[model samples]
Target: MASTSRLLFASSFSHPSLSITTGSDATRDLWLKNRKVPKEHCSKISMQHNWKHSYKCIDGGSTRDKSRGKFYINATSSQSHESQPQSFWKSTKDIMHTLQKFVMSYYLITMLMSIISSSLLAVENLSDISPKFFVGLLKFIIPITFMYFYAVGINQVTDLEIDKINKPYRPLASGKISYKTGVIFTISCSVMSFGLAWMTRSKPLLWCLILYFAAITCYSINLPLLRWKKSTILTLISNIPSMLLTSNVAPFLHMKTYVLKKTTIFPRPIVFTIAVMSFYYLVIMLLKDIPDIEGDKAAGLQTLSVRLGPKRVFWLCVSLLEMAYGIAVIMGATSPFLWSKFFTVLAHSIMAFVFYYRANSVDPEIKDVSQSFYMFIFQMMT
Candidate 1:
């Protein structure tokens, strides 16, 4: 019966006028008209696809599919495959972009350099530090990155209105991300930072991380009792601790994990570096508000630039930075090492000039100029 059915179906397919329909009913009708097999013994056939000269069928309860015109065979099991790795990499790229937006990628270098320089200065012996420093640096990066992302993410969430004027194109302000998602991401980052820090089991690191986080909390949150960012002086004072810890102290603590004793919290070089950075940070923070004067005024936040005017603020920033560079240059020139003086004087003199040139050329109302100089500050630090 099967042989007779196959021959009849083959003869019908050869006929030009007979159109084969790709449907179960069509298959059943054709099978019933040509074959005399009992319904119980004759398995149902499904026509999957149709072409000009071909069709494919899979019989019920059968593990194989047969094609007539262009016979194709599958020797492997009928498991489906997909491009999982490609999808995974695409998701990874998206995550990295979001992370960069959250943490401000340009500022990451400043943090990294802080760790490197602090580690170098923390140890009395320079020759002793080697590739191990970098290995340790890599490990320290995970927690620090999470902490920074959390801090900035919270700031973005709280300062959305101000950012709309100052940085409308930002991910949160521009509506690229929803506020709920931003809050969740920030909270996750906070948890990850603390979890990673706890895993390290270093007393100094845990202590420093706690202090940094406390300062960040006060700087960003709008709690009625602790709106630290509202006042310029309070903002500067609050941010100073986190800045010093992240840049100069965190690296030192990480590097000296095994050798840390009851020494002073701030080393000599760290104190000087933090002083310079505090002044630099204060200038940039003020300049940051210059472009947002309209928004700040609308929000009733009394930033320095709003009170002083942009031109005056611009010059103030330039002058303060110049003084910092001048002091650094003097320190280098007066150092016992002649090479230190030569390099410091040359590098700082060039930086001072560049700062002047750039600041002079800047249009005070333009936020992009402020951002450009902000990046330039890190470039010089590097």
Candidate 2:
């Protein structure tokens, strides 16, 4: 009976007009009419047809049809498999976009500055620049990088609306990354930062991370009385000390205590670098707002640019930076080492002139112009 049923089923495909129906009754009728099969066998064929139909539904693929004599593949399964790489690529792109817009340059600049400062101040001999030195530097930088991301991520999360106005290309602002994802990313970064800092068992590094975390929290978090970024005075207070610590003092102390196994001492270069960075960060805090005046105004954020107008604030920042450069020149000239004096004086002089030229070229009335200048300032920092 089974052999006969199989022969009948194969022969059914010979009739091009024969339609396969999912209904058991239709299938049984067709089989009986076409194959002249016995009544008892027809029930088995009908049951087979129903089972095939159920299997097709469950498998998400089409069953063989008599008319076409072809099996249909599972389209949904194939499409999902094909899209896995594309979905992964898109997610990766979104993450890169977020980093570039939010913290990529800042992270790179911070790491570069920290490494340079620490190496200059801590490394005294050729033996100091070894594999272990680099490994220790990596350990120090990893936690700091995580904290930097945390700080920027929290700011982006809190300033979503403002960023939509000022930085729409950002992941959170453009809706490429959900707010929940941003919050999760920030939390993860903070956790990883603290965890790594704890693992190092370095008090200076741990305290620096704590201070940075607190500073960013106060600057960005929109609690009832927080969000220091909305006020100029509070913004300066929160930013300057954090920048000074992170840029100069923290790295020096971490290297001296953690890597070099030496007592902490601020050399003339370290102190001078701190002073220069303090002034530079002050200018940065004010200059950064110049391009975002519109967004700040819309958000009711009383930034220097929003309070004093962009043109006035622009000149103010440039003048402050110029004065800082002048101070650097004087300090460099007075340095006891000839090479130090020559390098610092010449570099600052050249940079000051270049900064003046760039500042003169920027028109505060143009948004893109001001924004480009803001980025240029970051380049200068690097």
TM-score per prediction, in order, is: 0.73, 0.77
lDDT of 2 by residue, 154-224 (tens): 98999999999998988789887789988998899999999998998878789989998999999999998
Please give the lDDT score for candidate 2.
0.77
Instruction: Give per-residue CA lDDT, model 1, range 206-315, as digits (tens).
Output: 77678878888888888876767778888778786677777777777777663333254555567668777877777767777776788888878877887888888888
Candidate that would win on lDDT: 2
Q: Residue 181 CA error for candidate 2 (Å)?
A: 1.0
Identify the runs in model 2 with alpha carbons over 4 angstroms from their true place: 1-103
Superposed Cα RMSD, model 1: 7.8
| Backbone clashes under 3 angstroms, per model | 0, 0
Cα lDDT, model 2, residue 222: 93
